[model samples]
Target: VAFAGVMFHLMIGSVYAWSVFTNPIAKQNGWAESSVALAFSIAIFFLGMSAAFMGKVVEKIGPRLTGTIASFLYGTGTIMTGWAIHQNSIWLLYLSYGVIGGLGLGAGYVTPVSTIIKWFPDKRGLATGLAIMGFGFAAMLTGPVAQQLMASVGLEQTFYLLGTFYFVIMLLAAQFIVRPNLALSSITENSISQKKGTRLTRGPELTANQALKTKSFTFLWIM
Candidate 1:
């Protein structure tokens, strides 16, 4: 599950590599750099907004279904971006890459983090760090890959190719993800406590509504 989450996150996180494509896209379509850059900003804005709501959806539906849906939207969005570029319609690009793809990014980003934390109760921090680190480091690899793809196959084709790859990979990863078993989790926790000669302590659990009522939640929301 952890490995699958990391793999899925690695692909979804390539949204950060938008800078690599911005210049190429502008040069190809004779659009202003700032205008092309707005697509990235819009995508990020929707990423945050969708994440706020998608977290609730993930809790209601399992991670597997959520991840699958995210992959579909993200993949379709990427493909639509190719069409937008081919058609030279910036508005289409915004609707495709910004709104649709961003929603997928948010859902995909949260699914793994939430599931991995449950699997690794003994190492929640490390688990989450590893998953998110994939997102953080995605640009390092994707930048070079995108550059090479643009050089070899042109920008529109690059989007098509990448969208196909993301769709297949994310679907495969989602298939392997299942909720952690409560009985198995209890056994694992017991074994870990015995091996470490200490038991882990937990804070009071809160429901979604209860969490919203907290001062920290309110402050974070405002910020």
Candidate 2:
């Protein structure tokens, strides 16, 4: 259930569902369909670009920071997209949903996979599979939700409602999705043991360059 929550939070925020908002935005603005499509393409570009860096950042700073930042970025992006409507500035839409929101998507995308794997080490595959499943279903949920909210509140207000909902849910998931402490302790213990064994048998200190030149090292590198 915990794993499911993580997946739902991350995947539900996916930009795939952004298509649902496109027709309405274009119809209201009297813009061409092609122009609306461009927004999605740009947003996808940002999603891919941000994903490359966000994964490493997650590893370095941890999931909480990554998730928190993602929520803020995504939430602000949604709000800004709505603001773009009020202002009729297409560029603002791209900047918010395409750049900032995509960065959030990338960060949220990776956090749960690694953290959940550690939590359920024996069922890593299942954990990963379930986590991504929510992402796929997010669009299904978003489409109807978008329609209902649009009818009741209109486009501008719909963005605000979705933005606020995603922010709160994602923040909660980030706060609760913690890395297992045992993993760190185990790695530390192993490193200490390696250092202790090396201390007594210090025959010769080979630099990294020197080690690289050795036949055994060369063989291992090939493998």
Candidate 3:
């Protein structure tokens, strides 16, 4: 699950590579850089919005379905971005890359972390951090590749190729993220409770009088 989560993050983190397209899209379409940049902003906006609603959805449907849906939406959106650019339609770009792709991003972003959390209830923080590590490095991993693709094949083709590539990788990764059966619900719960109790209550207790008699308390009284 953690590995799947990493792969999911790696592909979706390509969102961070939006800057690679800004100038190329602007120049190719004869649009302002600001205009081209708006697609990225819109993508991010929908990403937040979709993520807000999709958390509950992930709880209900599970990550596999949600992750598959994300792959479809993102893959389609990326291809549409290429078509939109070829048509010189800014609105289409906004609709495809921004709204549709962002929705995919939201689903992909939540699926792995939530699923991993379920699998590793005790080490949720570590699971979440490990899952998301790919997102941080995605820009470094994908940025230069995108630049090279653009330089070689031109803008629209790059989007098409990348979209196809992302779709395959994300789809493959999504398969590995099966939610745990959870038939051992009671045991899992007990394990989590025991672990938490061990961590929080392991220290020796201090009586109230003994605490008050400490040197720190004396300094406070003087102040």
Q: TM-score winner among the candidates?
A: 1
Which residue pairs clash within candidate 3?
A: none
Residue 98, model 1: Cα distance from true site in angstroms: 0.2
> What lDDT tens digits, residue by residue, belong to model 1 across residues 1-223?
9999989899899999999999999999999999999998888888899888887788899999999998998898898999999999999999999999998898898888888988998899998899899998888999999999999999999999999999999999998767799998999899889989998677899998999899999999899
Per-model TM-score, in order, reads 0.91, 0.78, 0.85
Give lDDT: candidate 3, residue 180. 85
**Residue 144 in candidate 3, Cα distance off native in Å:** 0.3
Candidate 1: give the clashing pairs: none
Worst 10 residues of 2 by lDDT: 4-13
Per-residue error for 204 in candidate 2, Å, reads 24
lDDT of 3: 0.90
lDDT of 3 by residue, 118-147 (tens): 888768899999888998889997889989
Tell me the deviation in Å of residue 134 in model 1. 0.7
Top candidate by lDDT: 1
